[model samples]
Target chain A: MSSDKNNINLKLKVWRQKNSQTEGAFETLDAKNVSPDASFLEMLDAVNEDLIKKDKEPIVFDHDCREGICGSCGFMINGEAHGPQKGTTVCQLHMRHFNDGEELVLEPWRATAFPVIKDLMCDRSALDRIIRAGGYISVNTGNAQDANNIPIPKPDADEAFMSATCIGCGACVASCKNASAALFTSAKITHLALLPQGRVEQDQRALDMVAQMDAEGFGACTTTGACSAACPKEISLINIAKMNREYLRASVLKKEELSGGGDG
Target chain B: MLNFLKSTVGRKYIMGITGLVWMGFILGHMAGNMLIFLGPEAFNSYGHSIVSNKILLYGTEIALILAIIGHVTSAISLTLENRAAKGTRYAVMPKGEKASTWASRNMGAQGSAILAFIILHLITFKYGAHYETTVNGVVMRDLHKLVLEVFMKPGYVAWYVVCLLLLLFHLSHGAHSVFQSFGILERKMQAPLKKIAWAYAAVVAGGFLSQPIYVFLVNR
Candidate 1:
């Protein structure tokens, strides 16, 4: 809609917070003379430059590898996780997608598991802890195996690849009404469970990761499909179904087969 | 298994299993209620057959009661935990996926209301005034008379109307949610599964809904 305009000047209502310990509020600011081709984060950078020139503390947000691969740089833009564009991260969103003079509301992910570290920046370490608890396969170190060694089926490989694409951006958590980390946890579970190398510890992996996810105070999965719909990677809801199946296996698994956890 | 049930995923399995059980009961009950349109003979006979076999009737009753208990306990536990998990509400969070938020988001309120309705429903119908009737030289509960009498009251019909609506609202999400909880809802099956859930919910709830209005209006 803004293709006709060389630049779009917009109003921004950004969430400002000192830290998780304190209260947060919305701070209204203006972004003027912005190029339509500029990414969403670039517009923020421009606004930050202006704030610096005015001797004010600029807005704090998380971002790395502006290429959209770093699993960083995500905040709610008008309640839509990673902005309104489907399957595109905020870092990849251009200003042209938004109308000129539109009011852009920016806030960090809202969840007990993702506490605010600062303005538009939340601590997503809970996701890391889920991985640490057991998001791994039993791979021996040293020599690399050829990709064709496993002789995996094409569909399985494709599904595994899709599940592996989850960037851990917390968009799923932000989008879910319950703020359940089911999508994030399930994606890792699916990615690891599908491959042969990870199959050995699959039961324990599901158990530990899901237990850790619950321990993090994240909500339960209602299977509303919101997380999958809002996912930037388009992670399928099947991962969650797979996660459920894996957990079912854990319940039936004998004590000898279960090694407790994948903490090692 | 105890440790597994303690986990969120395990609790959901409980929710799913009980949910399906309720679905089956709802289907059978709604179908049997349709005999009301077939007159007292058919309705009374069906009721007679149900209570005639003490073991079967009591078994079904116990099973249904257990399903309700399982469904309620797990739902309450999950809801409380979910509430606490969302530490704070967002100042500007807009509604996401309208189709989802409507039923899924309101499941707690709707479920609680439905539970209350179930309690009152049992008292009114199961333990309602016992009227006797003889058909084919066999004594039976005049449930048809009780049904007709209750529906004739405007307030009772209105209550049924309201409760049926809540049932539909709750069923819309729940019908589909069962598949997800059981790990059966694959990507290819998502659309069909959702459609089946809606159709099933509508049929069961709608079937129950038609009775009160029919009884009240037809008799009047």
Candidate 2:
């Protein structure tokens, strides 16, 4: 143990893959005298810096907006999504959480739908496909409305806002055993379905988006609660139950066009 | 509707509903079988009442078979789908107290074992040996003798108990999972309902388990 706790050396077991088409393997690297306050990604950058000086290929990972709002930079750390700290993204995680000398394992998200593009970076565009299906309100204009114009119940607003917190990170898929995207899809569904502004195409939104999710080849939800626990934003599982209700309602009832309230 | 029927959520609904059907029948069957503890006369008459009406008997049998078909078909389809969805697993997996339970993870295996047991059960008692007896001036199938004979065999009794344990495992996860698939749970009700479902599973499975051991011991 150093008398001055300014610097700590650690071992990292990082996954290394050339590209999406190639096989990947783990490589052990030394991270020497790293600052305790450095973020996890910063530590990775330090290691990459050393690798470059040694004439080795620098480790490649996805990262942006180190503040954790960008929804980028997530991978399994010691088999845990976004590392051991609860509800914290890798960019927000600090080196002080680890032991003076610890070995960490990092891997990309695993799912048939999410193919690994490289070490610690998998293709999450399947999530984009789901949003493209029906993740928006039918707005006449993109401009903001007067905040007081619409009277939304406090509970409903809370529900919608809670669901809206999902940053589209793929940690839920990374943590799930079945690799289901129920949490992510449900959050999107609930984010729109709970507000009057989004009520117009609510039924259609549920149907098309869920269908798109299935088409992406994600597994059926096992309701294991791992996704909620692993979520960096702490999204609730109720969003999933609500989404199921919406899908069922849209499938069973809810005529496509109401076109009503008239005497012909 | 067809799209709903074919979706992953749709299959889950089918599995949950059909599973409920079987759970209802299990409770009824266990209660009816307990008539043996009353006496052969009581047991034989109870069996007679069920089989005397051909329409009702056939109707129950048909519904039960249909439930089995739906449950098993959806189960197999979901199993194949889940296998494909897992893709390539991580070399390093989360250890210690995972979010998935043994029952939730191995529902396919538990359900398959229960299905196999059901077939063997029907053969042993329902179609095994039919003895006739006149009770209260009405002749009826001597189901009591068949049940006693079946339970008297230690091998059959052991197999039956193990299957009941498997049923416990299947129901422990499935009963509460139905609420999730059907979207009938309130946020506050999830935990309490889960506990209630586990209790229900234990009671039904334990009830069935009690009968065979009791009969086997008496026969010995």
Candidate 3:
């Protein structure tokens, strides 16, 4: 729909909430004569600037680096996570994607684990808690080891690198019909489990992270596959399968250890 | 070990394993059902042979019952937890963004239909009239006559066909998903598994559906 026109006038329907306790609703406003080259966040900034000029509270949303690298900013644009484009985060979405006079809808991630904090921002600390459960390695770090001290196979390293690319963005959870965090949780598990350095605690890491994920009140993954489809990093759903393998193995081993082979 | 059952992944693993058990049962059941094509002598003899072995028949029946219980319980709990996870609903839901199948989304509804069908089927066939038929000068339960009598009625035939169709939808999703849930299927195997699932669903449904249609055509 991009043409000779340099600017597109749009109608924005943004979700606004006072806090988690209060009810929320959509606030429709005019986004007039916006430059097509502006990023989606910049367009929101323009709208907020106008609200401020009219003696109204500017729209509140979470955004750190307007760049797509940081996982700080994410909200549903229309019905799709991070807007209509595939593998494009909201921060990287350009206004040129929309046509003139098109009505755009925006809302925060709607999951029990993520409660609304303000207008377009929701509390995503639930993800942080899952990571804290065991998303790290416990190696001693007095001094940096030589680069080639521990050899990693290319395939394992590649797969591990892919899994590690997860930005902790809540898009997978938002896009899933079940609001499942399986993709996010599995990404962490698979990333660590694949590396030699992270292998020492792989069993415990899978167990604790999955236990923490369930405790966080997230839903079970039914393999609907929307999470991987909507993932900005294109995180594979295979990771979830790998995570399941890890959890099952660790659980049986732990049970054997606990019962001292009596159960067997 | 009990704590594992409480976790979401663990519950799904149970569902997967139990679903596989059910699939195996369906395959065996379908194979046994094919004896109807061999006429009354073979069909009745097959029925006689199954009922004659009391321990093997009862043991298999008990195992099937346990599998059903496990599958149904995990399904109900998982569905409730999934609903709770989605705290709020979107005002406008746009469709066709993803490649999700119709069967995958409505698994609960399809499963409920299958459950209802199973109850009705058991009452109609297993506990139907106790008529006796002489095969090779030996009296046995007339299961072949019962099947012919049931299939002759248009209403019963329609119901059976409808149930088989529901089963097709259920198996179309269940077969592939069970392997994925158990974490055994690899990335490269997904496409082939999906194809195999569709083929299995078609074959099972087709085999079961042919009986009533064949009986109706011959008797009419």
Candidate 4:
């Protein structure tokens, strides 16, 4: 609500840790002279500079390409994932949304599956495992084919596009009551299955992706919709339902030999 | 203990365990109810076998009552805690449509609906001639006739059908979750658990509703 850019000051309860093995605690710091136009990461950068000048170790947090596109600058801002804005990523959030002199609680993503690396950094490699198991078109490589060759309908393409927009940031897991990765895994599966290129691997994709998801120790989706609600990318929970449908269909089609796992 | 309850993980742990216990009761109850479709003789014999064994019947009923009480109490507590954490919103128009499942989000509403049906079921089916009527030196009720008579009415049968759908909705989301929450649902069990939940839900819904549908919609 403050139109005047000058009078911004805030307190941040930032979580601090030297390493994953070491214990951590919330270290309070003053966010001084914060510009209204500064992105949330830029504000953090300013604070880090202050800490370095005072002969203190800078707060460790992950950020690459301070733009929202990288999906790296995610941490719980006052118990809400990606800060208070409904759909804005942490990198995209501006100082204006917060009030001057407000105390903000910042913490690393807390989920059993997402082990903290140090401070706000986490090893999101579990998500990568899910992707590796199955998240791609499996067709043999060839030169570019015409878009018309696939003949994908507009509705299907739109749905696929929406699902494919998932940044794999693990916000869904952090926000979920069950810590489910269903939204992310489902998005990857649904995105491919909606297109002709991915149809060849539809059953395989569903089976492998789901297997990997379960293996990663992430909880199942209970349809609470918290993940979708907290997602900075605004990913839909409908993909979870779509994923369920695909899994069911694939299970029905799978032969007894192929039922266990792998391309039998 | 209070600190544990206040933590996010603690609250979820409570919700998960209690939720699973309730789901277990529903599955058992639905399984027993499915026997009704096997015909009056099969269902009545099954019912009499259980009810006639007074000790077992009493113990089972007490356990069921406890499950219901625990489920409702925990649910109320969790709801209150969440509401207190997230302050009242001030949106003038509506925000965008919520992405929650219809069944999961509407637990209280669906629970209330199911509770109404439970009371009605107790009054008309449980307390009516089906139970506690005496002759000479004994108490007895014709279970087969009671079922037939209950389903014979168009309005009563219609209500049964409606309640069965609600029960299905409740069970669909609740079944797999109970196991998952307790960390019992393993990687190997994922497919089977989901399948069993879906199949069990369908069979219960179909089997129980069919009794009334057969009497009112089909036979008539």
Candidate 5:
């Protein structure tokens, strides 16, 4: 572990709110000197401790795994989402990237659907709702097939992985002035639908997910590409274009019967 | 208008229009206020006349408020459509950093900053002692005196300068954005549009900043 000698002090202007119903405002705090090697979450932990020591409510934010694998922890750093580091998750971000005495403004993701649950914590479950609408493939439970039963080309698999890497963090939604999620949804749809196995329920998946995404009251994508820039996972706007194509295909084909006539 | 509102790009066009309209308002307001540095009596009467004309001022205020709300709503609606269009996600997105302006991407943030400043300014000056106040039977709105009281404060001048900076950035991107959203901006028009946007931004931003600098330095 790196020593604390390299740590720098920071001032944080964090937005605090009790819930979605209440109005929130920025509250400034002095972050004590801390290690530059500490993960972003660890730095938050340090700040939270100070708040607790003063008997004030610790800032409420979300984080599942500090390892950057779970796609939970996300908040604005200064004006940039996930800090100034490109292609880096918040939890993986280290203090060394920031200058000493800099004023960091932290806020929950700004989107209509993802309202602030509290300080730094936003209700991003709207994304999960969108996924649940039609993000899955229809497969049988009892089938144990050989790996050779389904042949996936290396390039296709790589593409699938590329699209599948979307953590669904809502950074795309947050960064967008319009708060659109087409990139995130299309990424999931294209990742699976591109493969032979996914083709079975591709049409249904596109229709259902897009319908749900709309019902969630999320805004439309204007192809501004801000979402991609702010995304911690760097999900591409190409996925959004793919989703548009898929939605058009599904809408036009109007196929009533899903593969195997089973609900996904 | 209804037909235009029905389409995808149409709604964005509306947003761009409303946004540009608000930007126009900002430019006009800044230009009008900068006359304060011309000397207290000159700036004072202008402020007084504006306040006295309840019909014009209130009408403009209502329109400004509506434009702001429309811009915000359109922005929200467009974002949702973009998200819904993406079927799945990719690890690499298009290179957005180099393509769009800083103001375009940070519209929401900039809007928030501007809104906060407006509220502060309204409370501190517009509705405060700077305006025509009543003491007994006397109508006491000293326009020149109010100008000095507000701008002579280094803090207020500094804050005004910051607001103008935000306005400048907003106009620079917003001017071109309106035309693009309308689909009126073609490859042939790009060069001219770029020049126009820069000039527009410079005039508005420069005009507004001139007020504070004049007051803080010359007037003081």
Candidate 6:
């Protein structure tokens, strides 16, 4: 592996689009020298600097908290979501992982629900809309409750925490051949459905969030296991299965309500 | 009810249930057909017993038809919806680095082939030339002779074997996926479930293919 002391030269093929309405194309640029210790985003920063000095338009990309925790930065690196590194986000990926004289192609997340807005930025509002539909507990808070007030089993808490690790990045959607949002929708559903506090609105949450997911034009999941593979958090595909169970239960309950034979 | 079926998850639920129903029918059908190895009298007797009761026979036929319809319609809708959702294709598509299988990816094409095979199979076996036989003072359709006649032909036997292989491909993916769709499969249980599905597919396909091979060799 190339270390920080060892610099490498590479060819970068980055997608460049003037705006959402315009067509995008790959712009080849030469990275003459780059520190192996630089993060992937920093490498892009170097390339952008070169473009600005040459009086060319700097490639635009979305990023925040370059530390990889913000969930604000993501783009396809060589047809793989978040580059070739496993469980690492784009911001956390380092130039050292790539070899010298490598040809790298970078593009935004590809999905009908996530349309490209610029060079490497896509509109991810569809995810936000699904969450808005019903991703939260409706509990009103006046004062903080003691952590031990509500007892949660260890396993359930651990699983809930795992499910809650989803960053709402569009990698799952990007990697899926069907562009399915099942993983993303399920992660949110599973996170809330596991906790006692989130159970009160569980049925509604499943129904509304799934409906919103469908409304956003994301494809149906075929359970090919690609989403979980592409997930930066390694979110389990079982979460999608769990969400299916919840959705089925909620649908059946809704049917009962429609027939006037059960509590809505 | 219609709205539920129209939704993606609801449609998947239908597909899962109907696919399982079809799997049940295939297993039972293969077991019954395996009686062919017991000679003409035994095979013919078993066939007669099954079709002897009009209610049981017609009920099963109708249910199978409905299952086929449900499975096909739901699959087509989901496939179309998925295609539309994809919007535009990536210029450079990459193979999934994780657990996707060929059977899982080509379910639509595999399902179509299986449907065509089913149509031809029903036509040749159910509506082809009839033979009558009498055993123990009871009259029965000589299904054993009919199967022999069908398998005696090289073209028919080849087609039957090919169809069985296609069915294996369809079932390999469908069996385990049905469980996943219903959310009945736990995380740890998925690997075992997949193994069971593959084993089931292999056994069913092997069993069905054995008949034609056996008949051909015996007659030769």
Q: What is the C-alpha lDDT of each candidate?
A: 0.88, 0.86, 0.88, 0.72, 0.73, 0.86
Q: After superposition, how far is residue A155 of candidate 4 from its true place, in Å?
A: 0.8
What is candidate 3's CA lDDT for residue A46? 88
The 10-residue segment with the lowest total lDDT in model 3 chain B: B92-101
Clashing pairs in 1: none
Query: Model 5, range A109-138, lDDT digits (tens) per residue?
Result: 777778778888888888898778878876
Each candidate: chain B TM-score: 0.96, 0.95, 0.95, 0.77, 0.80, 0.94
Per-residue CA lDDT of candidate 3, range A1-264, in tens?
Answer: 234458989998989899999999999999888888989989889888889999998889888887777888888877778888788789999989999999989999889999999988999999999999999998665999998999999999999999999998898998887889999999999999999888988888999999999999999998878788778888888899999999998888854244445323
TM-score, per-candidate, Cα-based: 0.96, 0.93, 0.94, 0.61, 0.58, 0.93
| Residues B58-109 of candidate 1: C-alpha lDDT, one tens digit per residue | 9988988899899999999999998888777766656555124677888989
Segments in model 2 whose C-alpha atoms lie over 4 Å from true places? A1-8, A256-264, B96-98
Question: How do the residues A55-81 of candidate 6 rate in per-residue lDDT, one tens digit apiece?
Answer: 998888888988767788898888788
- Residue A9 in candidate 1, Cα distance off native in Å: 1.7
Runs with alpha carbons beyond 4 Å of true place in candidate 6:
A1-5, A254-264
Summarize candidate 5's per-residue lDDT along B30-106 as a digit string, tens digits. 78877676665556667667878999899989988898788878766664565554322222223435134677656
Misplaced by over 4 Å in model 1 are A1-5, A254-264, B95-99
- In candidate 3, how many Å is residue B109 off? 1.6
lDDT, candidate 6, B137-186, per-residue tens: 99999988888888999998988888888889889988888887898867
The 10 consecutive residues of candidate 6 chain A with the worst lDDT sum are: A255-264
Worst 10 residues of 5 chain A by lDDT: A255-264
TM-score of 3: 0.94
Docking class of 3: medium
Tell me candidate 5's TM-score on chain B: 0.80
Candidate 2 interface RMSD, angstroms, 1 decimal: 1.5
Least well predicted 10-residue stretch by lDDT in candidate 1 chain A: A254-263
- Where's the lowest-lDDT run of ten residues in candidate 4 chain B? B86-95
Superposition error at B162 for model 4 (Å): 23
